[model samples]
Target: MKFDLHVHTRFSKDSDADIDAIILHAKKNGLDGFAVCDHDVTGGGPFSVQRAAELGSDLVIIPGVEISTSEGHLLVLGIKESIEPGLSPAETILRARAQDAVVILPHPFKLTSHGIGYIAGLDVDAVEVLNSRCLTDGPNNKACAAATSLGIAQVGGSDCHVPEMVGISYTEIDVQERSLDAVLDAIRQGKVRPGGGKTPKVFVMRQMMKNAQKRTAKILGLD
Candidate 1:
């Protein structure tokens, strides 16, 4: 099955894609499932799954969270409780693993997002080698190199903040079942392939402008 392993929803504060639109676009993109890795939040899991059911859609919404670790960002799937942010990457991975979660290094070379540079020595379960949000190939290629050098699993996702961007990048995994656990296990076992083109430059600019406007509104108490 194909899954966009990293994505965001309104719960992230920096994102605006609602559960309904996320499901709609995932189906439109021919995806079998997706994970909502809301930044520093872990409450979107059951909500997204329930909403998909309500819409009569069979898309699997995996429970996941994107942790803002002190070193960088980490996407952990198959875990529900929110791990406190700012933990070192190793500590974060330990906590996620305690829950049998799949730990993924997202945009591991993007400086602005705090991509930690030494993932090849970390105990991560996977590396996001194809993030749609990465404009230049440098970051993505660097991630790929690290994954290759370290023999870590590789995956991809849109890391999208808006509905239209969902599934712009994804992972093709080998799973015998269509359940969440099956997908997570597949990723952890390295039975996955990264796939996706870069997100359009226009969409990237639009997201940046939107974020800027939101920040301004919040500062002026107009949000």
Candidate 2:
């Protein structure tokens, strides 16, 4: 099964992707499933799942969150509740584990995007070695190398904030079933490989600028 394990929707302060649009585009992108991992929020995941069902789409919607840990970002999958942000990465992982969640270190070397710098002792279940939002492959390469050195599972995600970019990058999982449990279990056991291509640089830049504008507007109380 092909899955984009990181995505954001309007539930995220930085995104405006509609759940309905996201489901439509995911199907168009040939993805079997994708996780709604809105930054620091957990609501988008369930909302997306419900919306998919309403649309009669069978795409698997894994509930997840891209937590803003004290060190950087961590992707916690298979969880419905939000973990408090700003905790240490170790502490955050512990909280996710308590819920039997699968934790992934996303863009671990991309300091500009809040990537957790050194992943050696993080105790994460996987490392995002292919993030489509990366302008260059340097960060992704470093993440891949680190994961390889640490014997950690490697995964990929579009890190998309919009519906159109849904499957720019994805993790191909070897699963017998297309259910959420099977997908999470596959990732936990490292039965996955990163696939797909990077998002175009122009598109990535446009999205970044849009997010910046949104933040600026909010800061000025104009949003």
Model 1 segments beyond 4 Å from truth?
A: none
Candidate 2 wrong stretches, greater than 4 Å: none
Whole-model lDDT values for every prediction: 0.89, 0.92
The TM-score values for the models, in the order shown, are 0.96, 0.97
* Clashing pairs in model 1, backbone N/Cα/C closer than 3 A: none
Clashing pairs in 2: none
Native-to-model Cα distance after best TM-score fit, residue 129 in candidate 1, in Å: 0.4
Candidate of highest TM-score = 2
Give a tens-digit lDDT track for model 1, residues 111-139: 77667866767888889999998879999
lDDT of 2 by residue, 26-98 (tens): 9999999999999898999999889898899999999999999998999999995779999999999999999
Best by lDDT: 2
Specify the poorest-scoring 10-residue window by lDDT in model 2.
Answer: 202-211
Q: What is the lDDT of residue 58 in candidate 2?
A: 90
